[model samples]
Target: MMYKAFFNALTGAALLALAGAAAADDLVLEDAWLRAVPPVSPTMAGYFTLRNDGDQAVELIGAKTDIAGMAMLHDTETTDDGQARMVHLSGITLEPGDEATFAPGGKHLMLMKVDTIPEAGESVEICLTFRDREDLCGDFPVRREAP
Candidate 1:
């Protein structure tokens, strides 16, 4: 009886581990980093490329970080007058095998009212939430200069 219970528990654990692995394989985050801002600056920007490897589409709904009071998705657009303005986005969608890049002067994650200014070479934790996939949390490096 003891052997049977132990075997069942191990099997359950293995199944859960496999499920987690499969979930993680659905999405990939690459080259995540936070652009360094001045010590008294209230906002910073985070850039990354998110790739969806699954057969279905994924929607990046939002982002959050402990180091910021609020995080939001934004895009830079040119107006009729040729003035560049920042626009807020509700969410972004990615098709299968598609990669969405968040870069400076383009689409980016805006970190507002930062609690503390992160130093260069520091790693900050940011969580990206998707509509139908598991949240992706990564340690994004802080860079003093744009690459």
Candidate 2:
């Protein structure tokens, strides 16, 4: 009976360790926020950081938000003439243990045809669809200042 009890305890401990590891491998979203545009502006921007801790790489394929009629991924590229332009991106790949950041003057989400502009301190739900992983939905706060 003592031997059986020891085996059971060891099994339980192993299971707990596995669970902890899985939790650590989960993807994490940090500092999600949207830039507040003027009421007359037709477009706004969204930014965030996506961290992947899992063993496999993932691709961000698309994004959607109710606040805008259309949402798309974009990258800001500077030309030789010192002019910057927005380039649309179909998807962004992030390797395991890597992170992607969306910020002003860099990679960002273009929110076009905004139906309404949320006031500062309000939150907008943005759903990010992945290529092979489950989608992640985050509530991004509207802020005038940089994140």
Candidate 3:
């Protein structure tokens, strides 16, 4: 009888842990892709759609990738002269059901000091650091156009 009770408790605890883990991760990254740049290019741009599916708000602090010396968030802005320029973004916050789209002429991931630009038909992994949970990673396919 004691062994049976212990087994039940253990099973219950394991289930609870699994539920907690699922609840802890609330951010989903989709449509992740890297802009295919020239082989001699030292910088590249990565774009993706980030969605918050959980009830709570998620704050994205930064991004990192082994393929680049540094990865930073950026956005394109038009000046009074109608010229476009890239601005650095410190972070992004998304509420439940909110989706942030990183695309051309808009928010993007600027990967600088790349040792070797990944060719088209290849993929790279980029991890996003969040303030409320563990880092979330997604595979970004190298391409000339959005897919």
- Number of colliding residue pairs in each model: 0, 0, 0
For every candidate in turn, the CA RMSD to the true structure comes to 1.9, 4.5, 2.1
Local accuracy of candidate 1 as per-residue lDDT tens digits, 1-147: 999999999999999999889778878999999998888999999999999998888899999999999999999987889899999989889888999999988999999999899989899999998786678999999998776
For residues 68-108, could you state the per-residue lDDT of candidate 3 as single tens digits?
Answer: 99999999998889999988988899999999999988999
Model 3, stretches more than 4 Å misplaced? 1-5
Clashes of 3: 0
TM-score order of candidates, top first: 1, 3, 2
Compared with the true structure, what per-residue lDDT tens digits does model 2 show for residues 23-81? 44577888999998788889989999999888778898888888889999999998899
Each candidate's lDDT (Cα)?
Answer: 0.91, 0.88, 0.91
- Model 1, runs deviating above 4 Å: 1-9
Candidate 2: segments with Cα more than 4 A from true spot: 1-25
TM-score (all chains, Cα) for each model: 0.88, 0.81, 0.88
The window of 10 residues in a row where model 3 has the poorest summed lDDT is 19-28
What's the lDDT of the predicted structure labeled candidate 1?
0.91
lDDT of 2 at 136: 86
